[model samples]
Target: MKKRAIQILLALSLIFYKSTWFWRVFNHLAKPYLPASREFFQILLLMESGVLFLAVIY
Candidate 1:
């Protein structure tokens, strides 16, 4: 039960991070430093997808 809740929270966070509005806010807040680099973004996307997949399967 605890694990499931944690997974749900993580999935939600991932979805939020990938959202346009979230990025817009993030970019606005942190003007000088980018939120994520290309490589980092790719890795984050892969990790988020993998976690969501595992969550569904589990």
Candidate 2:
């Protein structure tokens, strides 16, 4: 049950990370602090997705 719940949350987070509106707001907030905010966000998303995928598999 616990693992299943974690898998569900990871799936939800994967979906959330793919949303444009969420990134728009994230970039808007992070742009001032980071010069290459979009690139950083993309890398972060990729890493997050990888971790989530591995978690779901294991």
Candidate 3:
């Protein structure tokens, strides 16, 4: 359990780091083809972060 939590924590930090530049570029490239997916992507990140939070907190 502790190992899993540590993994999630690391993933959360990686996501936080890449989200700014990497996600922006990726989203911009995909925007023309799938405008609505942007919201989905944001929600996906939100959920992932939430799960990671729970894993790290407890």
Candidate 4:
């Protein structure tokens, strides 16, 4: 069950990876709480996706 949820989340992130509007909205919403700029957040998300990929593999 947990693995399934992780897989679904990874899939969604990958699907939205190419959509600029998706990132824009996320950046806007997260701006106040997180100090990360758009580019930094994008990189952070990519790193998270990589971790999720590894988790799914193992």
* RMSD of candidates 1 onward, in order: 6.1, 4.8, 4.4, 6.9
lDDT of each: 0.68, 0.75, 0.78, 0.72
Model 2 per-residue lDDT at 10: 73
lDDT computed for candidate 1 = 0.68
Per-residue accuracy of model 1 over 1-58 as CA lDDT, tens digit each: 8987877787777676665565576568766776556457557767876777686658
* Candidate 3 whole-model C-alpha lDDT, 0 to 1: 0.78
Clashes of each: 0, 0, 0, 0
Residue pairs that clash (backbone atoms under 3 angstroms), model 1 = none
lDDT of 4 by residue, 1-58 (tens): 8988878787767756745667778878987987657678778777876776776666
RMSD of 2: 4.8
By TM-score, the candidates rank as 3, 2, 4, 1
lDDT rank, highest first?
Answer: 3, 2, 4, 1
- Model 2 residue 38 CA deviation in Å: 0.7
TM-score (C-alpha, index-matched) for candidate 1 = 0.39
Best by lDDT: 3
The runs of at least 3 residues in candidate 4 whose Cα sits more than 4 Å from the true structure, single-residue gaps closed, are: 1-24, 30-36
Mark the regions of model 2 whose C-alpha exceeds 4 Å error after superposition: 1-21, 30-35
